[model samples]
Structure formats: structure tokens, C-alpha cells
Target: MAVDLPGGVFRMGSDTHYPEERPSHRVRVGAFSIDETAVTNTDFAAFVADTGHVTVAEQPLDPAQFPDAPPENLVPGSMVFTPTRGPVDLRHLSQWWRWKPGACWRHPRGPRSSIEGLEDHPVVHVAHADALAYAAWAGAALPTEAEWEYASRGGLDGATYTWGDEPRPGGRIMANTWDGPDFPWRSTGESGFLRTAPVGSFPPNGYGLHDMAGNVWEWTDDWWTSRHPDDATSACCAPDDPRGGDLEASYDPAQPQFRVGRKVIKGGSHLCADSYCLRYRPAARRPQPVDTGMSHVGFRCVRRPATVEGTP
Candidate 1:
């Protein structure tokens, strides 16, 4: 399902979180359409069977990318889930995210797993390349930071959420997120998902889009560059629609160069909670290597319609 965002002007970014999101700005975007839900296993499976597509994680890792790392690690694989037994230590996400060989979208848990009864669930363990390929197969494209934030707002400009500023209205859980004691245990089922719940299980935003804020982070076409641009302050819109920096540079000057050009992932996932990595809001963003995938990350597609002479 697709929602046509007759895209126009909207304020972008927030001061409440990362420095990259500071100094909210105004942006003008041509009208475009976007998927109402993240792409599901069923959608991608067809693409896979038809094209014989193989994901980057399914291919051998380039040793030069991790020269000092173990040569044994240079095998086909992606992030594997390791349930936390106790309080999380933010310093080490690797404790729960292991690079398991044979782990891909079809086998989310690892070589031993399969999508099985979860065909309707949003496809996880997909890297940016995998997602782009699927988008191409569907004849749709990914959204820009501006376009994504605009659609995510559900036409409620600067409202703090897709539904409203309040995280919960009238004590009802509007989206899937951690509700129990932080990380390690007790998922109170506030959003009714211990991991990723089926897409559209919760109420849709005002624009009728599902899973805009949580469930899994959706991949954007934009690479992580110069944070999100200061759209308002700049007098003119960037010619490049998806204004990202170099695929070889980081927004943060201090970060390593090899991590540059990583694609930005939006809409924090269920694993994110107050205990650590609290990136569950629309404005929250993170970068994943173009070839990295995880159980908590997925993607949605956006259709960029060509400008017509008479539509307003």
C-alpha cells in the first residue's frame, strides 16, 4: 500500500537528541508517494526467487575492510541476536550482535533458522544493498531524510510524534517499543512485541502509515553525511534530492573514514529502550555499513512520481 505525500514544506530535525539533528529547518519537497508499511518477507521472497539475488552478507566479506580483524571472520554472514541475560553495557553492542555465518534475511537467527511462519512479518537482516535491490525490483525508491520525516509526521508538522507529542495518549500503546523494565528482561507488552511484531499491528498514523516510529528501523536512500542538512537556513534546496555527504566520509569528523558512506537507518527498533540506545522516535537516526544487517532493522519503499503539469 502507498500513501501519496503531496510533498511540500515542513520543518525538519529536533534539538532533543543528537547534535546532528539540531537547528530544525524548513524544507521544500516536490510531491512523492511512499509505502504505508515496511516491506515484508513475502514481498522480498518473490524478488529473490525471480532474480536469484544474493545479498552482500551472503557473499564473502572483503578482508581489507577488516585488515586487523580475524581472517576467519571474512566469511558470509551478518548480525546475529544474542539475548541479553542481564543489564546491558552500552559500550559493547557486539555482546548481543554477533557476526554469525549463514545469517541472512531467509535465516534471521543464523544458519539454523528460517523465516518459517513469519512470512507476513517485516523482512529483517537486510543490508542497504539488499533493500535497494528490492526497491528496484518493486520499481520504487527509498525516501530522503526530508521526505521521510515529512511522511513520518503524518501531516502533523512539528508535533513531536506521528500521532502527537505525548508518547502515549489515554494510556494506550500506539506503537511497538520496550515497555517493561529496560533491556535485559520483562517486556511489559506495551506495544505487544518481544522482538519485531507484524507490521501494521498498531494504529496507523494520521496519514494512515504503519510502523513509522518503531518495529524496525527503515533504511533511507541517503548516506550518513553532514548529519541532516540545515534545510531552512540554506536559501536554496540542494540539487541532489537525497543530500548526503560522501559514501566515504562521516558527519562526525572524529569517526573513522571506512565507516563513511554508511546508509542512515531511521525509526528506532524494539531493542531500543531507555536503558540504552533510546532511538525510538522519528527524528532518531543511525548509520549501518552498506553491507550490514540486523534482526531489528528493515526497510520501506518510496515511489517518486514525476512532476505533472497540472497537479497541485
Candidate 2:
């Protein structure tokens, strides 16, 4: 199902959170429709069955693209999160994230794992191209970063969470974020999931959108910039449905040799924790490489008013 949102102006970033979301500013988006929840395993299976489409994670790596990669590591695989046995250095994410062979959407954990009973969970291990392909097949498009943040705010401008100002209003868990304070090691299992949860497992946002804060990180159409541009000079000057940085600026400076572009990804996943990654909020944003897919990344689609119902 999809929700028809009558978009309007809202605060787009968070100065209170990570630096990437600084310069909290107002932005406007045109009316659009967005999927109520992330695309699920059942949905992706149908698209694959109909189009015989192949996901990036299922394709062998190009040696030229990974000249320094070991020969054995060139096979198809995806990054999977493995909880550490005990406390480890939180600064190094390598402690818990591993490159698991055969860990595509079909096999979330690895070749040994399957999505047999997880058809309703958000599909993971999907790269930006895979998401775009599915959107095209479904006669939809990926949401722009502006449109996504506007929809996620759900009329609560500048609220910390999609629901309200409080993280857990009235002591009720609003979204499916990491359960315990200890991350990458111990899980209290309070959220009822250590990974992706079923769509709509938690309460919907004020906009009738489900999983807007967590469950899985969602791909956006905007290229990534280190931080949001300065706020518009005035309300009338606020950029309408603003786009993000240019392709050249989206490349990671730390790994310039790869020349890979990145896009903005919103909605922190189930792995997000208060102690580690406190990003399960509407304003939080992250940059993800366009060619990479991980076990916690998935996407939903959007449709502008100008788009025909059954046409992209």
C-alpha cells in the first residue's frame, strides 16, 4: 500500500544530532505518493520472478574495480552484521560487520540462511541500482531526500522522532530500533528483533507511514553531501524540493581511487542503538555507496503527482 501525502514546508535537518544533519532548515516538496512501508521479500521475489532481474549482491565483483581485493573475496556476497561475543571497540565497525559470501536478499545471513518465513520483512542486500530497477519495474521512483524527510516528519516539524518530541512517548516503544543500550555485543531483545522486523510491526507515523524511523535504512534519490547547505535566507526563499550534492562531490574523499558515488540514505535500521548509532529519527541521514548493498539496507518507492498511476 502507498500513502498520498500533501507535502509542504518542514524543517529538513537536525543540528542537535550528527553533524551531517546540521543547519536545520526549511524545505518544501510537491505532493507525492510513497510506499507505506519498505519493499518486502515477497515484493522483490515477484519482481525477480517476472523480470529475472539480478541484484548487485548476486553478481561477481569486477577485478578491475577491486584491484587490491583478494581473489577469494571477488565472489558474490554482501555485508552481514554479526554481533560480537563481548564488548569490543565501538569505533571500529569491522568488529561486527563481516563480508558474508552468498548473503544476498534471498539469503539474509549467508548461503545457509533463507527468507522462508520472512517474506513480510523489508528486503535487504539491495544496491541503489537494484532499487531503481525495481522502482522502474513497478512504475514508481525512489523518493528524493527532500520528499523523504518531509514525509517522515509527518507534520511534526523539528520533532526529534517521527511520532513526537519524545523518543518513547508514554514509555511505549514507537519504532523498531536496537533494544538494549549495549550494541554489537548484547541485545536485551526488547524490540522483539535483532534485525529487520516485519513491516508495520510498529505504530505508523502521523502521516500513516510505517517504518519511517527504523526497520531498515532506505535509499534516496539525492546525491550525498557532508552536510546540508545553509538554510534559505527567508521562508519565501527556501528551496522547493531541493536536491542534494553533485556527483563529483558525492565521492568519498577517503577512497578517491574507487571513484564511487554515494547517495543519501535515511531511516536508521534495526541495528541502530542509542549507545552506538543513535539515528532512528526522521532527520538523521547517512551516505551509502551506490554500488554496495548490506544486510540492513532496503528501499521504498515514491510517485509524483505528475506521474501516471501505472507508468514511471
Candidate 3:
């Protein structure tokens, strides 16, 4: 089911959170319809079966693109989150993420793993191209960063979470996030799933949209910008349906030679924990390479009402 959002102006970003989310701004978005839940494995399977679409994680890597990569690592695969045995440095993300060969959407854990019982779970290991192809097949479009963040807020203006200021209101888990201590492996099981939970498993937001704060990070159409543009001086000057930064500006300076532009991904995943990555909020955002997919990353689609010739 798709929920119709009566779009309007809203305050976007956070003034007291991650550096990237600073400089909170106001954005105007048009009315649109978004999926009530994240795109599930069953939904993506139908698209693949009908279109014979091949996800980026399933295709072999081009040697020319990664000349310095090892020959053995040139095989098709995607990044998978493997929790460490004990306490480890949280700064290094490689401690829990591995590039397992053949780790596509179908084989989430690797070549041997299958999605037999996870049909309703949100599909993971989907790169930007894969998500775009699926959206195209479904006759929908990926939401822009502004649209995504707006919908995620679910009518809540400046609340810290999709639900409210408290992450776990009344001692109840609202989304699927890592409910554990500082250690990456330990899980409090409050969210009910170690990895990706079934779509709509958690309570929906004010807009009746599920998994808006957690479950799996979703792909957005906008390129990643370090921070949002400053708020317009007046309502008449507010940006409408802003697209975000350019491809050149989205690249990571540390990997200057990679030449891959990143898109803005919203909604933290099951790996998000307060002790570590406290990003399971409506204003929280992350950057993802267009060509890379991970076990904790997935996406949903949205559709905007057609505008009349002379309508604003």
C-alpha cells in the first residue's frame, strides 16, 4: 500500500546532532505517494522475475574500475555485516563489514545463504542502479533527499525521532535498531531482529509509513552533501524539491581516485546503536556509493502526482 502525503513546508535537518545534520533548514516538498513499507524481497523478486534484471551485486566487477584490487577479490559480491566475537575498536567499520563473494540479494549471507524464509523481509544488497531499475520496473521513482526526510518526519516538525523525542517511548521499541551496549555483538533483542526485520514489523509513523527510522537504510535520489543549505530568508525564497549536491562534490576526499559519486541514504539500519552509530532518526543521513550495496542497506520507491501544465 502507498500512503498519500499532503506535502507542505517543514523544518528539515537537526540543529543538535551529527555535524552533517547541523544547520537545520526549511524545505518545501510537493504532494506524493510513498510505499507504506520498505520494498521486500518478495516485491523485488517479482520485478526480477518479470524483467530479468541483474543487480549490481550479482554482476562481476570490472577489473579496470578497481585496478589495485586483488584478482581474488574481483569476483561478484556485496558487503555483508558480520558482527565481531568480542570488544573491538568501533572506529573501524571493517571490524564488522566483509566483502563476501556472491553476497547478492538472493544470497544475503553469501553463496550458501538463501532467502527461503525471508521473503517478506526488506531486500538488501541493492546498489543505486539496482534500486533505480526496480523503481523503473514498478513505474515509481526513488524519493529525493528532501522528500524522503519529509515523509520520514511523518508530520512531526522538530521531534528527535519519527515517533517522538524519546527513542523508546513508554519502554517500547519503535523501530528495528541495534538495541545493545557499546559492544557491536551484544544485542538486547528489543527490536526483535538481529538483522533486517520483516517489513512493517514496527509501528508506522504519523503518515502511516513503516520502517521510516530503522530496519534498512533506504536510497534517495539526491547526491550527498556535507550539510544542508541554509534556510531561506523568507517563505517565498524557500527551495522547492531540492536535489542536493553535485556528483563531484559528493565524492570522498580520502579516495580521490575512486571517482564514484555517492547518493544520500536515509533511515539508519539494524546496525545503528546509540552506543555506536546513533543515526536512527528522521533527520539523520548517510552517504552510500552508487555501485556498492551492503547487507543492512535497502530501498523503497515513491510516486508524485502529475502536475498540470500551469500548476505550481
Candidate 4:
């Protein structure tokens, strides 16, 4: 199911949080409808069955993309999060993230893992191309970053979280974020989920949309930018449906050798923890390489109103 939002002006970013969300700005968006939850395994399976689509994680890595890697390591695989036995240096993400061969949406954990009992869970291990393919099959489109943040707010203007100003109102757990402070090691499973939770496991926001805060990081249509543009100086100058920076500008300057473009992925995942990536809020975002899909990343689709009879 989908919820239709009468989009309008809303404060888009955060001024008090992460640097990337600096210079909170005003943005206007047109009316659109969005999926109530991230695309579930069942939904993705249907799309694959109908279109015979193959996710990028299931395809061999392009030789041009990984020239420095050994030929034996070029096999199909996806990044999987494996908790460490104990705490380690948080600076190095490699400690917890491993490239597991045969870890596609079908086998989320690895070759032996299966999605048999996870049909209702948000489908992970979907690269940008895979998400786009699913969106196309459903006759929908991935939401722009601005549109996504707007809907995620759920009419709660300037709220830190999707629900309200507080992360957990009335001392109750709101979303399926990391269960404990010892991230990359242990999860208390207090949120009743060590990883991704079933959709709608928590209460919906004011728009009646569920799973907007946490569960899995969701893909957006915008290219990755280090920070948002400055707030408009005048009401008339405010951007309407901003799509973020160009693809050329989205390349990771730190890794010049690998010219892979990145896209903006919003909404924190189950891996988000207060002691670590405290980003289960509306404005938080991160850059993800177009060709990579981790076990904690999934996507939802949006249907924009046609500008004309045949136009997007």
C-alpha cells in the first residue's frame, strides 16, 4: 500500500546534527505517493519472477571496476555485516563488514543463508541498478532525497525524528535501531530485532507510513553531495524538488582511482546506534556506491504525479 502526500514547503536538513546535514534549508515538493514500507522480499521476488531480472549482487563483478582485485575475488557477492566477537576500532569499517560470496537478496547472509523466513522483511543486497529495475517493473520511481525527507517527517516540522522531537517518547523504543551501545559487537536485541525487522513492527508516523526511521537504509534518486546547498535567501529563491549534485560531482574524491559514482541513501538502518551512527532521524543521509549493496540497505518506491498526460 501507498500513502499520498500533499507536498509543500518543509525544512529539509538539520542545522544541529551531522555536518552533511548543515545549513538547514527550505524545500518545496509536488504531490506524490510513496510505498508504506521498504520493498519486501516477497515484493522483489514477484518482480524478479515476472521480469526475470537479476540483481547486481548476483552478477559477476565488472573487470573494469575492480582492476586491482584478484580474478578469484571477482565472483558474485554482496557486503554482509558480521558482528565482531568484541569491540574494535570503529574507524575501520572492515572490522565488521565482509565481502561474502553468494550473498545476494536470495541468500542475505551468505551462500548457505536463505530468505525462506524473511519474505516479509525488507529485501536487502539490492544495488542501485537492482532497485531501479524493481521501480521500473512496478511503474514507480525512486524518490528524490528532498521528497523522501519530507515524507519521512510525516508533517512533524523540524522534528529530529520521524515520530517527534524525542527518539523514544514515553521511554518506549520507537524504531528498530541497534539494540545496544556496543555496536559492531553485540546487540541486546531489545528492539526485538538483531537486524532488519518485519515491516510495520513499529507505529507509523503522522502520514500513516511505517518503517520510515529504521529497519534498512533506503535508496534515493539524488546523487551524493557532501552537504546540502545553503538555505534560500528569499521565499521565491527556494528550490523546488532539488535533485542534488551532478553525477560527476558525486564521485568520491578520496578514491580517485575508482571513479564509481555515489548516490544518496536515506533513513538509518538496524545497524545505527546512538554510540555510533546516530542517524535514525529524518535528515540523516549517507553516500553509497552505485554498484554496492549491503545487507542493511534496501529501497522503497515513489509514484510522482504526471506533469502532463504522458510526461514524468
Give the whole-model CA lDDT for all candidates, comma-separated. Answer: 0.79, 0.93, 0.92, 0.94
For 1-312, candidate 2 gives per-residue lDDT tens digits of 999988888889999989999999988888999999999999999999999999999999999988998999999999999999999989898999999989999999999999999999999999999999999999999999999999898889998999988888889988888888888888898878888899999998888999999889999989999999898887698788899999999999999787999999999999999988989888899999999999899999999877577774
Whole-model lDDT, model 4: 0.94
Better of 1 and 4 by TM-score: 4
Every model's TM-score: 0.90, 0.97, 0.98, 0.98
lDDT of 3: 0.92
Q: Where is model 3 more than 4 Å wrong at Cα? A: 310-312
For model 4, residues 1-312, the per-residue Cα lDDT tens digits are 999999999999899999999889999999999999999999999999999998999999888877888999999999999999999999999999999999999999999999998999999999999999999989999999999999999999899999998878998999999988899899898999998889999999999988889999999989999999998999887788888898999999989987888999999999999999989999999999999999999999999977776665
lDDT of 3 by residue, 12-130 (tens): 99989999997898888989999999999999999999999999999999999989988898999999998889889988999989989999999999999999999999999999999
Stretches > 4 Å off in candidate 4: 309-312
- Which candidate order results from sorting by lDDT in descending order? 4, 2, 3, 1
Error of 2 at 156 (Å): 0.6
After superposing candidate 2 on the true structure, give the runs of residues whose Cα lies further than 4 Å from its correct spot. Answer: 307-312
Q: Model 1: per-residue lDDT, tens digit, 1-312?
A: 898878777777787777767657777777788898999999889999999999877889788877887878788888876777776676777767777899988998889989888788899988888998999999998887777888888888887777888878998887787776556445666666777888898889888999898788889887786456555445666333446567656444556545535777888887776666557666777877776788888999998876689885
Q: Count the backbone clashes (under 3 Å) in each candidate.
A: 1, 0, 0, 0
User: How far off is residue 98 in model 3, in Å?
Assistant: 0.4
